[model samples]
Structures are given as C-alpha cells and as structure tokens.
Target: MKKQSLVKGAFVLTLAAFITKVLVFSNSIVLSRVLGPEGIGLKKMVMPFMGLMMTLTTIGLPVAISRLVAEADAQGNRGKVKKILVISLVITGSLSIFVVSLSIFSGKYLSSFFLTDPRSYNSFMAMIPIIPIGAVSGVLKGYFRGRQTMNPIAFAQVFEQIVRVCLTYILVQRLVPLGIEYAAAGAVLCSVLGEACSLIFFIVMFKISHHRKMKISRPSWSQAFRGKNVLIELLQTGLPTTGNGFVISITRAVQPIVITKSLALAGVSSALITKQYGMLTGFVMPLLFLPGFINQSLGATLVPAISEANAQNNLRLIKRRLNQAIRVALIVGVPSTLLLYLYAHELMTAVYHAPTAAPLLKLIAPFFLLNYLQSPLQSVLVGMGQAKTAMFNNILARCTNVALIYPLASNPLLGINGVILAISVGVILETILHYSSVVKSIGYALDIPNIIKILVAGIAMGYIGRALFINLNNLTSQGGATLILLTGIVFSIFIYMLLLFFLKVINGSDIVRIPFVGKMLGKIFPK
Candidate 1:
C-alpha cells in the first residue's frame, strides 16, 4: 500500500479507537459513581475470570486470522484468505460454545475459589451466554483488520461501548437501590449486551465487504475450505502470541486473589478490602490508563504494517516503523506520566470525589508509563517474530510479582501500600527484561540520549504544573478541587508544548507525523 493509504487508514481507525475509548472512559466514571468501592470491588473480583474467558475465546483466533489474510494477500493467494476466515469461524465458534458451557456448569465453583463472597456466583454465571458472541465477534473484527478495512471495526467498538454503558447505567442506578450485589451483576450484564451488539455489527460489515470481493472472483466454498494450509498458517503465527495473551489474563486474575488473601491475613475488614481495592485498581489505575487509548490506537495500526514488512523480509522498513512507533510513544508517554505524577491527587479528588484515592494514584502512576511503553513495544516485538522472548519476560515478571507481593504486604511497615509497590517493581522488571531482549535481537539501543531529552522536558513541565496547582488550590474555594486541577492541567499542557517547540525537541519532521500537531505546528512555527 502507498504511504497515503496507510496514513488515511490509520487515521480513520484511530479516530474510531479514540471515540470508543472516550465512551469506555465515561462509563468508568459513571460506574464508579453508581457502584462506589464495594460495587466496583465486586466487579474487580470477577475480572480475572472474564479476562481468561476473553483470552480463550478470541485471543488466538484474531491474531491468526489477521496474519493469515495479510500473508495470503502478500503472496497473491487470494483463495487462502477465504479459507482462513472460514476455518477461523469454525474453530472460534466451536471454542466459544465449549467455553460458555464450561462456564455455565463451573461458574459457581470458580466464583467460590476466587471471590470469598459467594454472592458473586450469579454474576459469574450471567457472563457465560455472552462469551460466544464475543468469541465470534473477535474473528470477524480481525478479518476486517487484516483487509485493512478498519472503519467497520472501529464503529463496532464505539457501538459496543455505547450499548454497554447505556444499559449498565440504567440497570445499576435502578438496582443499586435494591442492593450492591444486584447493582454489580447489572454491570456484568452490560458485557453480555455489548458483545451481542458488536457481533451483529461485525457480521453486517463482513458480509458487505465479502460480497463486493466475491463479485470479481468467486472460489468454491469447498475449495477454500479443504486446504490444510489454513490450519498450519494460523497456528504458526498465532500460537506464540496466544501465550502472551493467556499470561496477561492469568496475571490479572491472580491480583485479586493475592490482594484479598494478603489483606485478610493482616486482619483488615472485608469491607475495607473492597474499598481499598476499588480505590487502587478501579478508580486510580483506570485514570492512569486514560492515555493508553492513544498508544493502543497507534499500536493497532502498526501491527499489520510491521507484519507485512517482516513477511517480505523488509528489515529497513521494520526498523523505520519501529523507531517511528517508539518516538510517538515517547512523545505521549513521557508527558502523560509526569502530568499524572504531578497532579494525581488533584485529579482523583476532582473526578472520583475520593480524597484517599489520590495517594493510590501516585503509587500507580509509574506503572502507567511502563505499560504504555511495554504494550506497544511488545506488540512490535511479536510482529517482528520475537513473541517467545516477550512471553518469557512476562512469565518471569508475574512470578516475581507473586513472590514479592506476599512478603512485602506481610511487612507491618508497608501494609496496603506494599501491594501497590510490588506491582510497580514487577512492572519495572518486565519493561527492563523486554527492552533487553529487543535490544539484543535488533542490535540497537533504545535511543537513550533522545529519551533523556524527552524525560527532562516532561519533568520540567511537571514542576511547572506542581507550582501552578499549589497556588491555584490556595486561591480557589468555589469551583473546588476539580476546577483547580483542571486549570493546572490545561496550563501545564500549554506550557509543555511551548517549551518543546522552542527547544526543538520535536522538529519539523516529527511535527508532521502526529495526528493534529501538523496544523497547529504550522501556525506556531509558520513554515
């Protein structure tokens, strides 16, 4: 594809991604308010199961389909595309039914094993029927992504979030008055509804696209379906990344079990545990992840591009694209990290109305940056066929996390903070290990000098932000903490960009690469 086509495609997809993220973010705020800590905590308790189900149902299928389609197109074997899609459909559909059945029969036991409160059992049971919808949707979405037809995929994302949020808000608001457990279950019910809507949307788009393509050259369904090549191709590309997805899901599942058991050992009340978990992971971490929507949007675009280049043995293009992705990640990651560090408390107080969440946000801010870097970087590595190294690093990190969390939280001095600290340490270790592997494999450093320059700029911005907010807090009594924080955030962003431009930290070429920065940079710099 031409550079123009690539840019246009990425832009449309990114817009869809950003919009969907905004919708999800808005729902996060709404859910937090309606559910509070207990309701949120209940949801968090069940997250691991949901994550695991998602991984099993969709993880390998999407990766396999997208790669097979892209690879087939590159090799001029158009017949393989349809074959891969059909095989993916059959495989994923079968897995979805099996997984849903397993969940239905075993959800109560799974709930008891993970969640101490048996009341969450029904919620787990409720999530079963929705699994198949999500499973099939994942395959269709990947097929579209492979074709580089991203608009439909993007719209489906937005549609899913809208449906989920609207339904959950009504259910939770009405049912919370009845009880928190019911309210919590209502939230899980939203997932079922969202998945159904998304599946329908994907089917519609896939048919339309497939219909147009079929008119030009039709291959017999039997001919497309009979080839053994489809199975081999999907397994070859998809299996390695499947481990990465499973590890992530499993690690997330372990978190609640670890934290809850540890807190119990410390004699903390169950009620308090729920609140603390909600405050830390729910309200705080999500805020820290707000910037990730941007990184992920870019990452989705980079995957196919990187995969295609690598398939054709285009090393120079791979490096160029990798560097470009890293640069973009740094530009957003550095400033976003500093901004969170500087104003975490103020931001939390403004949004969640929970002053206690401020400190938790501070503890979790570094991980946000680490994740923002690691997520896309890891995807790039996998695209480059380095999934084995990525898998090893993640496993090592999770193991280290499990070992350290227990001992650290057991210490009387650290208490609850120890758990948060453990997560940060584990994340730092994971990032280092992943970076080391990438550096060794690629034989290049991560541009340390450029990284330092960006970090310095970000720190300078943070300092200015702290000073402005400190003063603003002293002066404001009307709009309260939220307004003061908002003012500081706006001022800090403006000042940061002005400094970056003046210092030539972001040059002409870099300016043109960003989504909207080009037009603004043109006005300010006057090309």
Candidate 2:
C-alpha cells in the first residue's frame, strides 16, 4: 500500500507537470505567433523582473509551507499545519498586493526601457493583476504539495492552462489585428485571466478538501491563525528557499537583456534581435529542460522519504537515496538533451515553424543537462537540511551569470552568440558550485562516471541521428522531414539504449521501471 501510494503520487504529479509544461509551451507559441518575435521578446524582457517581484512577494513562503506541513504531518500535528496555512495566506496575500501595485505603477517605464519597443505597454499593464492572483495560487498549491495531496494543484494547473490557451486564442485573434499594442495587451490579459482561473480552482479544491476534513474534526480558527508559530515555521522553511529561488529567477530573467544588447552591438537591427533570442532561450531551452519535470517529481517523492531517514540518523539510507536521485536525474536529463540537439531543427520547425532557430537550439541544448540534473541535487541538499548552501550556490551562480553576461554581450565581436555563451558559462560554473556542496555535505564525488557514460552515449547517438537525418533530408521531399526526423529519433534511442545495455551503464531493471519504457522493455527483453 505504501509503495502504491508513492507510485500513485509520482504518477499524478508527473501527469500534472507534463500538462503544465505543455500549456506553458503552448502559451509561448501562441504569444510568439500572434505578436511575433518582437512581442514575445518584449514579454521576455519583463519576465525576469516580474519573476524577481513574484519571488520576493512569496519569499519562498509556499515551499516553506509545504515543508512545514510535511513536518507537521510527520508529527501528526494537524493544528500546526493549519496554523502554517493561515499564516502563509496572510503573508503571501499581503505581499501580492504590494507587488501588484508596483507592477501597475511601474509598467509604463519598464515596458519602454526593457523592450526597445514602447508598444508593449498594454501587455505590461495586463500583467499587474496577475501578481496577487498568482502569489495566492502559489501558496495554495504549495500547501497541497506539503500535505501530499497533489490532485488539487494538478487539477488547478490543467484548469489554468485551459483558461490561458482559450483566452490567448480569443484575445490574440481579436486584438492583434487592431495593432501590436492591442496584441501585447491581449497576451498579458491571457496570463492574468489564466492565473485568476487557477486561483479560483484552487480555492474550490481547498474548500472541498477542507470540508471533508472538517467532518472528521473541526479546526479552530483562532488556533489555526496563530501568528507566532506560523511566522517561526514559515521563516524556518521559506526564507532560505526564497533566496534560492531568487537566484534562479534572476538568472533566467537577465538572459534577454544580455542577448538583446549583444545583438545590437553586432549590428543586428532591433527589429530582428527578438527572433535571435527567441531561437535559443525561448524555444530550444524549454524543450531540453522538459525532462526536469521527471527529476522534480522524483525529488518531491524523495524528500519525505529522506526526511524520515534524517529523523532516524540513517546515514546509509540517505546516501543510497541521494545516489538514486543523481542517477535518476542523469537517466532523464542526458538522453533528453542529446535528443533535443539531434532533432533541434525539426523540433523547432515543428513547434515554431522557424528553421533558422536550429544552430541556437544546438548551442543551448547542453544546458538542459545542467538544468535538469540540478533539481535533484538541490533537493538532496534541502532534504539534508542544507537549504542555505543551495541558496548560496544559486546566488553565486546568478551573480556570475550577471557579471559574465554584460561584458560578453557588450562585445561587438560576439553578438547574440555572446549571450548564449554567457548563459552556458554561468550554467557550467553553477553546476561546479552545486556539485562542490554536494560533495562536501555527502562526502563523495557526484557520480562523475555515470555522467561521463551518459554524455558519451548521448554524443554517439546524436551523431548517428544527425547523420540519418541529413541523409533523409537529402533523399526525401520537404514534407517528409517529420517522418524522417521521427525515424532518426527512434534510431537514436535504440542505439543509445543498446550501448548502455552492453556497457551496463543502466540495466534492464532500470529500463523496466520507467513508465512506458518499462512495460515495453519487458516485452522486448524478456527476463
């Protein structure tokens, strides 16, 4: 029953995250298609700043809420969990108001300066309303995650994405024909409406869940609203995590600023620069990073298990679990990055209808490996109660990213490639810092042999896939590209897995445990 429950939780969360990622990808595609690269570029410009605001407002409180609630669950302390929830709502909600105000009042100046085009002002305005709604929704979702009740968050995500896609389709089609300004407004409004819908869905879900619990044992409002305890717990969990999240948000947000400047100095026109940035950061990077969803789900499931082991001072089990986390991260991340690079053009053309994005996609695909692997590593740190280390490592990386970006991007010689290089540089540095901490805390190198194996396997497979793709493109008509690309992908997976199997890099058992692959492997490679 326990194993089943864990698997169930992981499965649901995976589905939820997968859907959320798809929705987000859809949102980006629609925004880009409707407003073009210029509009999407404007949105990207504001994203980092908005992310900073949202991070500060929430201040890691939602994640802290989850941790606190989980801790309370371990102790069978419902009163403590209730108190944390109430406090989380109050703190997150209040911060949301302040952020919303800042966004609204500062929208005009921000839109003009961040984006080369001033026409994105209306879209900026639409984003202001999203702050408060988004923050509240975040807290609620975290609350559910902590309680090990993922359905509420999952359902809310699906509902939110549906709302977002529907609104974007309706609004963009109606508004973009009016002018770029109206298109921008429509884009922002889609976000605001989507967040609002998610918030409402969460509220309903929370109420239903709470009502069911109420029938069992009434929760006292006064007790649940205890300020002092909630504040202490919230601070204990949220503050450090907030710092960690801040680092990540800031690092991602600044990519555009760096890229745009780099392009401008390279003699690229402002009008064309957005497309360049979109090619790498906006499109390719997301697909590469998709496997992180698996890592995240695994990390989430591992947290409670690790927490239990921690309470018992079970060092061996913790080490075993940590190794498992790293292995799982590699298993997902390595193949995904390679596959992305192999089919970079096909994937980009299929999704964005833009073939020019191919080179940038290849350049940025490596970061997918770095990005996804870090999630599990970070989780291991948090589980071990070293959230401060994780926070500092993230801060250091973001600072390095910022520092590297400006100088590299300002160089007239490098252009948009400078920005891409800067991002990759920062990522490599960050990975080093993170791994150092993992080693210091756990007293072992971060499975370097496994990483090497994965990399080699990926490279060999990528080469084969690319060769096949090139041949196909030469032999077949343009419309046959999709069929050829799919064939190459299948071939890549086959070769990679066969090599890994022979090398014993990953065994049949590991393959048998992954969702669809496991069942298929059973049929193909009978025990």
My TM-score estimates for the predictions, one after another, are: 0.80, 0.76
lDDT of 1 by residue, 1-527 (tens): 12223344566666777888788789999999999988888877877778778787765768667656655666767777767777776666667778988988887787777688777886787777777787778777777766666677778888999999999888889988878888888898897888899889877776676444642233344544586677766766567668877776677778788888887777777898899888988888777777776677666666666667777777777667776667667778888888877777666777788878888777778675777667666766666656667778888988788778787776767757888888888888988887787677666456666677777777888899789888877787676766677788888888777777666667655555445556676655622
* Candidate 2 per-residue C-alpha lDDT over 302-384 given as tens digits, one digit per residue, 9 for 90 to 100: 66545545646677877777777777667667778878776777888987888788888788777657776676677667766
Q: Rate the local accuracy (lDDT) of all candidates.
A: 0.74, 0.72
User: Against the true structure, whose lDDT is highest?
Assistant: 1
Candidate 1, residue 108: CA error in Å? 7.8
Worst 10 residues of 2 by lDDT: 1-10
**Cα displacement (Å) at residue 290, model 2:** 4.9
In model 2, the runs with Cα more than 4 Å from the true position are 1-11, 24-53, 100-129, 168-190, 207-211, 214-230, 245-292, 295-305, 340-368, 405-421, 444-460, 463-479, 497-527
Q: How many clashing pairs does model 1 include?
A: 0
